[model samples]
Target: MQGSFCDNIVRSSTKDAMPDSLGNYLIPTSYSRIVARELGLQERELPRLLEGTGLPPHVLLAGDESRISGQQQLQVMTNARRISNDPAFGLRLGSQLTPRSHGPIGYLALSSPDLLTALKSLRDFLPIRIPFAQVDLHEQGQSMACDLTILLPAPTTQLRMLVECFALVIQSLVESFLGRELREASIHFEYDRPAYGDRYEKYIHSELHFAQPASRVVLPAHLLTEANPEGDANSYAAARDMCAALLEQVPVTALSMTDRVKRFLLAQPAGSVNEENVARSLYISRRTLARRLQAEGSSYRRIREDMMAEMAAVQLRQGQLSVESIAVLLGYHDSANFRRAFRRWYGCSPQSFRDGVKPE
Candidate 1:
């Protein structure tokens, strides 16, 4: 496996963070795709990524996305490192997890109005992507810091993989967002530098600082306000709405009467999924709908806003209409009113939301 790994590193060489187990958060198994592609693994060799994790190779290669438990993911990474015998293998993987690899989150980064907003979105929404990741943003006198607090119950090997991967992943993402290398930035790791990796200049753009209190990346404060050229009102709004809705929709299954109503509302057109229609769809009288929702500690109006926020996000992500057009479609007479309502729902201006949604 090590020989194949060395050869593959030379052949493929290119690829794709982590934290601890917080409340049984599962990781996407599609990471196997990154391993396979980056390691130049042949079709039959794809099983190498999941080898001893009790997860099958086909699941690793599954066209649809699948998730595995934290323990299972650690086992998989353990196998990856064992096979590679390269201390910096995780950094190699991080190089491939470019900003755009994150789907809606990628849209948020690319369409942000400025670098600071993009970084915040990355900070705010990353938990939705990687649940155990805790990124603390701080402003020092001359620079900004992104600190990752790891709470993983894993061996040093797995922890190394996690930290190294996160370091380079952030480096790649910020560079992509800023459209330049982060020469004035640096990454600090809590662990000592491995003998095999002294600089790791290829994957991480910033100067490397090891043996720190926490693993973090710091950049000059002046760079934070730089505007992104790709930003626009439409794309940013849509991307933001999509990300916010995705966050709201986590735990994916509807466990409450309120949740079930949200699911029902989301399945139908936005404007038509009103109180009466919702009651009808649930096969209940309006009064019963009211009573059950009240018992569930929710109400029709609150649930409707959730539905509308999600609908607006979906439309914004699709990039087929202007924010004003979407507002009207959702029955808002004034676009400014829609903007205010959207902010209340998602915590950003309607145009600001589009800054997170990249225009298609």
Candidate 2:
């Protein structure tokens, strides 16, 4: 792969980002080599799937080559999937397969009332689990859309299969949740059309766009408002609250809109921050900010409140600072207002949050 192209595919810190969590699930390069050997293919033919590129397959397997172009990596996956006949082979091979992996996201998506809601739930919940991939839900003409952007520091040698598997899993889960396939949606890829594009079309039963602006799956806008057969309003509310609390506690450990907002706040130590301020810093609009957060099943107000609560809780627990000082740290006008907000946040007064809870 060209150096520039490889740079685009991999993440900034490749060594730290490898998915080793899927213990027995990882089908390493050695495993692939074994499969190829069983099929009577020479080691030289291993990289043949990447016909135009002179790089060896071990570069991807051994972590020697830091990057691979998204296009080239996709091409290799398409060829490998075709030859291997395992639709889930790539994810099963690449990921750290574990019970705790991917978390409440699958449940939230399934429990949502409509396709839009399900997608929004995924957008909100995915960050707590898979930080490497950012998924967006947007309105497209009369339809709705989902964009899946993967952030990896190393060449995703099996990204094609990973994308296909994610698309399949999302589609299947949507159909299972709504009790029907997406009737008026389409799938799009940022990479070039591959050899198995037709198969993708047949599986999705929708138009497939290649080399698109981004990697996304589009659905009709009406799907957003559809009544969910499995809807449980109370449960969803509780889940949302729990997630909000989680976001406040450890913002940097995860990739989330909430976490991003917290990071932004930490970077700007002084002042009252709001959506417009955050949007300006991010180079996006207030309207776009609202829309994106809505897709994530949260609002700027919610994240802001969470940040304040967390800051207050931390200061209070330290017990070294007075209530007035803590209030100022959180950009409050006075202790009374900060106390009210604290009570609302933890169902107890600021004094209680300080004195009652044990350190985490």
What's the true lDDT of residue 224 in model 1?
A: 85
Q: Report the lDDT tens digits of candidate 1 across residue range 80-128.
A: 7777777678787778787765544566676777888888877766654
* Number of residue pairs clashing in candidate 2, backbone atoms closer than 3 angstroms, sequence gap of 3 or more or interchain: 9
Give the winner by lDDT: 1
The whole-model lDDT of each prediction reads 0.67, 0.55
Q: Give the Å error, residue 196, model 1.
A: 1.3
State each model's C-alpha RMSD to the native: 16.1, 18.0
Candidate 2, residues 1-360, lDDT tens digits: the string is 112211322332244333444311112222233234333343346665555545465443211213344344445555666666665445433332211123345545655666676677667555344445567777768977777766644344455656654565556656665676666668787777775555564566557788888778787776677776754544443333334344334533334554555555543332455677676544446887788778889887887786667666655665656787767655677779888877777888776666785322
Clashing pairs in 2: 10-152, 10-153, 10-154, 11-152, 11-153, 11-154, 21-96, 22-96, 22-97
Highest TM-score against the true fold, candidate:
1
Worst lDDT window (10 residues) for model 2?
22-31
Error of 2 at 187 (Å): 1.0
